[model samples]
Every structure is written in structure tokens, then in C-alpha cells.
Target: MKSSMATPVTVSDITENPHKYQFKQINDMTGQSILNSFDAVFISNSVAFNGGLNVLKDSIYHETINKDMRYNINIIKTAKKNENNKELKKLVKLFHSKEIQEYVGKKFDHKKVEVKKQVSYLK
Candidate 1:
């Protein structure tokens, strides 16, 4: 006759039990600075490509994995209709301008994300 033993469970084993785990959401600055504190850190391409990690010494390694992140320019109909919204309209127009697009392209790595043609909605 042999005695039977039970297997020990881990945090992953209790997937359905919310109380078994502790969760905390840290700001981007803290989270990026402390990569070793967690198993993994996830970030958007804009952050990664724009030298967000340049502040840290060569303690971390990164790779560029292409992701589809669409950038858009939108204006609310109500804002467009209001005559007093000249400033808002001016800002929107600037966003659609070629100069602004070029600036954005330079700001964010153009190789990863491209600025497509601007779309306008006229009444």
C-alpha cells in the first residue's frame, strides 16, 4: 500500500478567483523605469519608437513588431456649426495641413507609422 499526496497550486491555477491575485496599475514613467519588477512590460509603438526608453541605461532590449495603430483627425458636428469655434476649426485645419503631417511623421518614427491623406467633412 502507498500513501497519496496532493499537488500544490499556484497563482495561475486560481484563474477564476479574483481575490487570489493582487493587481496594481502604475503610470507609464514608473512602469517603464522598473522593468525588472514585472515579468513583462507592454507599450505602444508610438512610445517605443519615439525613444521613450532612451532615458534608461542599456538595461533593457527592445524590438520593433509592426502593429496597426490608426491615427485620425475628427471634428464634432456641433463644434463645426458653432460660429464661435474659430479657434477649434483653425486647430483642426492645422492638423490636416502637410506641414503638421510632416512634423508628426518626424516626431513618431515614419518607418513604423505613415501619415495618410487627410479627409475633410464639409457641410
Candidate 2:
């Protein structure tokens, strides 16, 4: 005669029942706690340029780890558009100037941030 009892195979076998398993989403508090525990984070140049990193304070240090990343500022207008709005033209020109490029590079401590002249709105 055979025994009626069965041996347990593994933890997975004990928890494999769908009715006994549950999944929960991570809340904001838990998410923030995880972020706070990290020593460093990699963020895009645009975020740093916009002063997003200031929130991290001096406890965390950051550098532009990726030099190839680029951000573009585009001015969109109708296809038949002409330079009728002087102020808009001036703003576009100012954005493409070397002065503005130098300012952005210095502001973010990133040498790669510069006006992409080939794809300039003026072109």
C-alpha cells in the first residue's frame, strides 16, 4: 500500500498558486526613498541645462558623462513663412549666435552644447 502524503518540492511550488500571490505598485514614498539612496544618476544635458540637478544639493556630485548627446531648439512656422516678424527673426538669430552657444556650454559645464548651425532655423 502507498502513503497518502506528498513531499514538498520547492518554495516556488508552495507559492505557485495564483490565488495566494499578489502584486503591488510602488508608491511615491518608496520611489523617492530609492532615488535618495543612489550615489549618482545619469541625466540628459537639457535637464542639467534647465537647472534640474540643483535639487540634489552638494551631497551628490554629477558630471556630463555622455558627450555625444545633443539637444535642439527648433522654431516652427508655416511653409510659406517669410521674415515679416522682426522680433521672431531676432530671437531666432540670437539663439544661433556663438554667444548663446558659449553661454549654454558654460552654464552646463558641457562643451558639447552648441548651436547646430547646419540645422539652424535660418537655413
Candidate 3:
């Protein structure tokens, strides 16, 4: 019989979670540089493997396909701009609220009538 659910935790799953996974600062820089150098070497080797310098004359094309990648940058930018405008409007309304205006000695108007603050009596 097959198991209903496999083990929830996996090594790859743990590595991908930013909150749980962290790289050492030293290792991050050094490892990245090493990886970059290796990538450069690989590129050099790949070119050398396929007829050294003659591959460029044929106009050979090499494409790296990333099926998982999707970009909606325009949508994100538009959404942010819209949200910021909404937040600004909310702030303006908050500052214009009755309690806030009173603190700043500002008066409210309605029907060409101004409401005056009632004087507090001391007992």
C-alpha cells in the first residue's frame, strides 16, 4: 500500500525558505565568487568543446530556457502607485478629521455655518 502523505520536510524545501535558511556572510561572498569563476570556466570549456573558435562563424545559437520565470513588473508598479495614492488620500482625510483639526485650532464649516468650541467650566 502507498502512503497517503510523504514526509512533509525535505532538504530542498528547507533551503528555499528564507525565514528558516541563512548563508554565512563569509561563505556567501566567497562561495558566490567561486561559483561565478566556475561558471566563467564552464562557459570557456563549453565553447572549446564545440569546435573551439569555429562555432561563432556558423552563427550557432544557445538558449537557456527557464520555464518557471514570469515577470509582471508593470502590474506591480501600477499597483504600488495606486496603493500609495489611496494611502495619501486616507492620510489627508485622517488629518482633516474633527478630533485632529481641533488639536491644530482649525475650524469646521457646514452650510456657511461655523461651529465654535464650547467653553469648559471649572468646578
Candidate 4:
């Protein structure tokens, strides 16, 4: 005999009727946001570190830390035949006296490009 007051729960019941039990929805939107934010920060930091590292690796830094100006100076130092290249000459002299070796060698030194933050909402 079947009781009219009893509820019949089948496999389909759980999927179709959510009100009969506690329903759980695993939405990854929040997780995706956190992951995206983390990835952005990691990528930005990586780029910044690489930029700073390249500058440090390529330039002669005995005192002050400088970036791409080293290439100009190198060009000036090497271009002895062309006396009329005054534009190049001036840029070399502009950054000639600066030496920034130790700054680049520092452990914590990095050129940060961007930063990211995470937020969440509850409903």
C-alpha cells in the first residue's frame, strides 16, 4: 500500500525539484575573478622585473641606476669616425657621468608596471 501523504523521490526529483532539499550551486565566478586578478598581478610583476633586469644587465651601473640610456652612450663611445653626429654626442654626454651598478644588483629592486586587487559581493 502507498501513503498519499508520502513524497516520491526519484533520480529526476533532485534535478528537477530543488525545493525538496538543500540546493547547492557551485558558481566559479568568484574563483575566476580571484584567479584573473592573481594572474594580472603576476604578469605585471614579471614584466616589471624583466624590464628592470634588462636595464641592469645591459648598462654599466657603478652608482646610479639608469635604463635605456646606456645604448646611446655606447653608440657615442664607439662612433669615433663620425664627428658630425652631434645629436648622438649630446645624449652620450647627458648620461655619461652616471654609474649605477649596485642599484641593479640589489635583491629587492624591481620596476613595477601595474597592480591588481580582488573584491567580492554577497547576496
Top candidate (TM-score): 1
Question: Compared to the true structure, candidate 3 yields what TM-score?
Answer: 0.19
TM-score-better candidate, 1 vs 3: 1
**Model 4: residues >4 Å from true position, as ranges?**
1-48, 51-82, 99-123
Candidates in order, TM-scores: namely 0.37, 0.33, 0.19, 0.19
Specify the poorest-scoring 10-residue window by lDDT in model 2: 1-10
Clashes found in each candidate (C-alpha, N, C closer than 3 A): 0, 0, 0, 8
lDDT of 4 by residue, 1-123 (tens): 122225532334454554454433322334323433432221123343444433334333322323322221222234557656878767655543234333433443533111111111110
**Residue 60 displacement (Å), model 1:** 14
Whole-model Cα lDDT of every candidate shown, in order: 0.47, 0.45, 0.33, 0.34
**Model 3: residue 58 alpha-carbon error in angstroms:** 90
Q: 1-123, model 3: which lDDT tens digit per residue? A: 111124422233433454553432232224323543442221221233232322223223422222211120111123445756876667656755777666544221210111222122110
Residue ranges of candidate 1 with Cα displaced over 4 Å: 1-24, 42-87, 110-123
Model 4 deviation from native, Cα RMSD in Å: 24.2
Model 2: per-residue lDDT, tens digit, 1-123?
122125423333444456654433333334333545554433433444353344234324544323222133333443446657787778777877889878866765553434444434333
* Lowest-sum lDDT 10-residue window in model 3: 67-76
In the predicted model 4, the residue pairs found to clash are 61-100, 61-101, 62-100, 62-101, 63-99, 63-100, 64-99, 64-100
lDDT: worst 10-residue window of model 4: 114-123
Q: After superposition, how far is residue 119 of candidate 2 from its true place, in Å?
A: 8.9
C-alpha lDDT of candidate 1 relative to the true structure: 0.47
